[model samples]
Structures are given as structure tokens and as C-alpha cells.
Target: MASHLDLEEQEQLEQVKAFWKQWGNLITWLITAVLLAYAGWQGWNYYQRQEAAKAAAMYDALDQAVQAADADKAASVFNDLRERYAGTVYAAQGALQAAKVQQDKGQADKAMASLTWAADNASDDSYRDIARLRLAGLQIDAKQYDAAAKSLDAIKSADFAALASDRRGDLLLLQNKPAEARAEFQKALAAMDKTLDYRRLIEAKLATLGVAVPADDAASGAAK
Candidate 1:
């Protein structure tokens, strides 16, 4: 019985060896590939963290330059951040800050350039929307009413709809198109939150056009 058990164990060991001989190399290569992939992923995460930290530091410096009212320094830092880290949110924010500084310094052309860059390249849609809104306002100030209207028309956010409509009304009013202005004012009134004083202001505009907004209906619509 001892000899029979020994023979059985030997046969089992031989079978296991045959299986390993057939598949061992393939199994080893698969495990190596998986480990390499995991290592690469971890390395990439570390690289991204480092890059973001550097971009954030540069953005802070740009903000400080803007706070000091150093338009030239702010512009230089902002350009560097935008060129090097355009993929980062901080870069877009830095551009907006630089644009505001340029505007305050009476450099309308430079301000528009920064705003246009932010509008075109911001990684965040919300940031791009804000840039476009600000650019439109500047265009309006420059009396480029048609271009401002076109910019406002391109904005698609429901949250910005009221403000965009109000801006459109302003542009139309500036152009002496009272009927078109009234239409935009009505749309603004419809989009605005009932509790907001701005909604009342829009309502007043509509009233001037002999278009009465029903208070109860507006309140009920807002409640919904």
C-alpha cells in the first residue's frame, strides 16, 4: 500500500510539471505586463500632481501681480501660465484676472486679447461663458453692438439666459430698435427668478412697452 501511494503522488507531480511546461512562459509574461501597466499609471498620476502644483504656484504669482496693479508683470505671468498650462483651470482664471487689470489700466485692446484667449481656450465651459460675457460687455462699451449681440446670442446656458437676454435688450435699445428690445426684455423677465429685484426691473421695461406682466402668474410660475 505504501508503494501504491508513492506511485500515485509521482504521477500527480508529473502532471503538474507538464501543465507548467506548457503555460508557464505565457503566465509569466501576462503578469509582467499587468505590473508594468500599473506602475505606469501610478507614475502618470504623480507627474500630473507635480504639474498641477507648479501651475497653481504660477497662477498665484500672476494674481499677486494683478493685485499690485502691475499690468505688464501680470500680462507676462498670465501669458506664461496660459502657454505652459492652458489645460489647467488656474491658467484660464489667471487670464481673466489679467484682462481685468488691463481693462482697469485703459488698455482695452490688450484686455480684449486676454478675454478672447480665455473664451477660446478655457478648459472649463463655465469659465469660457464668463469670458464671453465679459468680452461682450466690452464690445458693447466700444459701440460694437452687432458683435456684442452675436456673442450674447452664442451663450447657451439656461442659468445665464436671463442676463444674456437683458444684455440683448440693452444692445437693441442702443440701436433704437424698441420692438426688438421689448421682446428681449420680455424674455429676460421670463427667465429671471421672481424673487430677484432684477426681475422687477425687467418687468418695468416691459411695462414701458405697454406689455403688462401678470404678477400672480409670474409668482405661480416661479413657485413651480
Candidate 2:
């Protein structure tokens, strides 16, 4: 009976060895792959956190420069942020703020440069739109009618449909095309949100062209 039990135990051990020989390498490789994947994930998370912290610091500097109305410092910081952390949203925002400060400081050319960079490099479409709109406004001020038109035309997003039409109207009006301006302004009025006070401004533009907006339009309500 003791020999019988011994033989049974030996047979069980042999079966275990056979299973290991068949699947041991595969199990080991799978475990190694899992461990490597986990380590890579952890490392990526750590790197992203470090990058975000650094970007946040730079953004704070940009904000301070903007608040102090230091155009040169703002431009310098903005350039640094864009060069080092252009992937961050802060780079686009910093460019916008820097452009404003620089423009206010009689650095119109520099401001346009910053605005152009923001318009071209912003990861977010809305930020790009904002940059392009402001750039168009500046171009209009500089009597760059054709460039302004091109900028407005580049804006393809529907989110800015009303604003783009309004700006186009302004450009046409500046170019002494009153009829075209009137049409664009009317289009702007139609596209604008009824609740926005900005819609009233479009209505006023239409009125300037002797085009009466509908009585139910936000323009009439604002007048009342």
C-alpha cells in the first residue's frame, strides 16, 4: 500500500512537469509583457505630470507679465513657453495675452506676429479663430483690406459664422462696397444668436446701411 501511494504521487509530479514544459515559457513571456506594459504606463504618467507642472509654472509667469503690462517680458515669456511647451494650451493663451499687451504698448507689428503664430499653431480651433479674428481687426486698422478678407475667409468653423459675417461686412464697408456690406451684415444678423447682445450690434450695422431689421429681431428689442 505504501508503494502504491508512492507511485501515485510520482505520477502526479510527472504530470505537473509535463504541463510546465508545455506552457511555462508562454506564461513567463506573458507575465513579462504585462510587467513591461505596466512599467511603461507608469513612466508615461510620471513624464506627463512633470511636463504639466513645468508648463503650469511658465504659464504663471506669462500671466504675471500680462498683469504687469510688461509687453517685452510677456513676449519673452510667451516665446519661451511656445518653444518649450507649445503642446500646452497655455502656449496659445500666452500668445493671445502677449499679443494684447504688445499691441497696447505700440508694438502693433509684434502683436500681429504673435497673433499670426497663435492662429497658425493653436491646437484648439476656437483659439485659432480668436487669434484670426483679432488679427483681422488689426489688419483692418492697418488698411490691409485684402489680408483681412483672407483671414476672415480662412475661418471655416460654423461656431464663428455670425462673427465672421459681421467682420466681412465691416471689411466690405471699409472698401466702399455698401451694397455688399449690407448683404453680409444681414447674413450676420440672421446667423447670430437671438439672445446675444452682440446681435444688436449687427442690427445697428444693417441700420447704417438703411436696411431695416425685422421688428422681432434682437436689434429692435435692444432699442426698446
Candidate 3:
């Protein structure tokens, strides 16, 4: 009986060894692959954090230039930040701020350039939308109607539908297309939140077109 038990144990050990011989290399490779992937993920996260830190510092410098009313310096820093860190949220924000500074300084071309860049290259959709909206408004002021139309047409988000319609209505009115403007103003009013003060502005626009807001719509849009 002792000899028989010893033989059984030896057979079991041999079976285990055979199994290991067949699968050991695959198992080892799988574990190595998993460890390497984990390491790569960690490295990517670290790289992103470092980039954000550097971008934040650069954005702060741009903000200081803006606060000092140094348009040239602000533009310079903004160009540098955008070129180096265009993937960062800070670059988009800096573009918006730089555009504001340029606009305040009566640098219409520079403002438009910043806005155009943000519209085209902003990392965030909302930032891009904002840039497009502002760019359209400036283009309208400059009587670049075709460019304004193109910008307005590019706005795809439903959240900005009301504002886009309102701007389009303004553009139509400027071009003496009151009928078209009236339709757009109605769309703006319909899309806008009832509680917003801006809805009143849309109502006023409709009034200019000799159209009155429906009684129910007007009541809903009134202040609570």
C-alpha cells in the first residue's frame, strides 16, 4: 500500500509538470502584458497632470498681462500659451480673455484672430461655441455678413440654439430681411428659457417686426 501511494503521487506530480510545460510561456506573457499596460496608463496620467500644471502657470501670466491693460503683452503670452498648450483648457480660456482685451483696445482684427483660433482649435465644445458666437457678432459689426452667417451655421449644440437664432435674426434685420428676422426671433423665443431676462430682449425684437408674442408665451416669459 505504501508503494502504491508513492506511485500515485509521482503520477500526479508528472501531470502538473506536463501542464506547466504546455501553458507556462503563455501565462507569463499575459502577466507581462498586463503589467506593461498598467505602467503605460500610469505614465499617461502623470504626463497629463504635468502638462496641466505648466499650462495653468502660463495662463496666470496671460491673465496678469490682461489685467495690466497690456494688450501687446497679453497677445504675446496668449500666442505662446496656445502654440505650446493648445490641448489644455487654459489655452481656450486664454483665447477668450485675450479676445476681450483686444476688443477693448479697439484691435478688432486681433480680437477676431483670437476668436477664430478658439473657434477652430478649442479643446472644449462649449468654448468653441462661445468663440463662434463672439466671432459672428464681431463679423456682423464689421459688416462681414457672409462670414457671420458661416459662423452661426457652424453652431451645432442645442444648448446654444436660442442665442444662435437670436443672432441670426439680428443679422437678417441688419440686411433688411424683416420677414426672415421675425421667423428667427420667434424661434429664439420658443427655444429660450421662459424665466430668462434675455427672453424679453427677443420679445422686443419681435415687436420691432410688428409681431406680438402669444398671450401664453408672454405670460410664461414674464418675471415670476
Candidate 4:
């Protein structure tokens, strides 16, 4: 009985060896691939965290420079942050801060350039919208009316529709297109919240054009 049992064990061991010979390389490669993938994922996560920390620190420096009213230092730090961390929100914010500094320093052209960069390249749509709005305002001040209109036209935020329309109306009025201005003002009035004081201003604009907005229109505008 002992000899029979030893023979059975030897047969089982041989069978195991045969299985390994047939599948050992494939099983080893599969396990290695899984481990490599897991390691790569972990490494990438760590790298992203490190990058975010660096960007955050740079942004903090930018904020401090701005708060100290050091436009030159703020501009330098902002440029560095924008160049090194363009993919992060910090870069867009830095661009805005740099633009503000340039504007405050009476560098209108530089401010416009910075705002244009942010408008064109910001990762967030809201930030881009803000940049475009500011750039349009500057263009208007410069009497580059056509360019200002084009910039304002590019804004697509539903929530900002009323303000954009009002700006367009103002631009049209400046261009001596009273009819078009009236139309834009009406659109603005339609889009604005009825409760907002700005809506009353728009209504006044429409009234100035001899377009009487109904009371119901005003109430409905407030409801919005």
C-alpha cells in the first residue's frame, strides 16, 4: 500500500510539471503586465499630485505679489506660472492678475494681450468668458467698436446673454444705429431678471427709443 501511494504521488507531480511547461511563460507574462500597469497608474497619480502642489505654490506667490501691489513682480510670477502650469486653473487666474496689473499701470495694450491669451487658452469656459468681456470693454474704450462687437458676439453663456445684449445695444447706440440698438435693448430686457435694477435701466433704454414695454413684460422680466 505504501509503494502504491508513492507511485500515485509521483504521477501527480509529473502532471503538475507538464502543466507548468505548457503555460509557465504565459502566466508569468500576464502577472508581470498587471503589476506593471498598477505601478504605472500609481506613479502617474503621484506625479499629478506633485505637479498640482508646485502649481499651487506658484499661484500663492502670484497672489502675494498682487496683494503687495507689486505689478512688476506679479507680472513676472504670473508669466512663470502660466508657462510652467498652463494646464492648471492657476495659469488662467495668473493671466487675469497679470492683466489687471498691466491695466492699473496704464498699459492698455499689454492688458489686452494678456486678456486675449486668457480668453483664447483658458481651460475653463467661465474664465474665458470673463476675459472676453473685459477685453471687449477695453476695445470699446479704445473706440475699436467693430472689434469690440466681435468679441462680445463670441460670448455664448446663456446666463450672460442679457449683459452681452445690453453691451451690444450700447455699442450700436454709439454707432448711431438707434433701431438696432433698440432691438438689442429689447432682447436684453427680455433676457434680464425682472427683479434686477439693471432690467429697469434696460426698460428705460427701450422707453427712450419709444418702445413701451408692457407692465406684464416687466413683471415677467422680474420673475426671471
Candidate number of the best TM-score: 3
Could you tell me which 10 consecutive residues in candidate 3 have the lowest summed lDDT? 215-224
TM-score, one value per model: 0.85, 0.89, 0.91, 0.83
- lDDT for 18 in candidate 4 is 99
lDDT leader: 3
lDDT of 2 by residue, 1-224 (tens): 99999999999999999999999999999999999999999999999899989988998998999899999999999999999989888889998999999999999999999999999999899999999999999999999999999889989889998899999999999999999999999888888778778887887888888988777785445754
Q: After best superposition, candidate 1 residue 164: deviation in angstroms? A: 1.2
Clashing pairs in 1: none
- What is the lDDT of every predicted structure here? 0.89, 0.91, 0.95, 0.88
Model 4 C-alpha lDDT per residue in residues 1-224, reported as the tens digit of each score? 99999999999999999999999999999999999999999999999899989999999998898788777888889888878889899889988988888888888888898889898999998888888888888888889999999889889999788888988888899899999999999888888777777787888888899999998977766685
Evaluate model 2: give its TM-score. Answer: 0.89
Q: Clash pairs of candidate 2?
A: none
Superposed model 4: Cα runs more than 4 Å off: 1-19, 216-224
Clashing pairs in 3: none
TM-score of 1: 0.85
Model 1: per-residue lDDT, tens digit, 1-224? 99999999999999989988999899999999999999999999999999999999999999999989999999999999998999999988998999999999999889989998998899988888888888888999999988888788778888888888888888898899999999999888877777776776787777887888897846754565
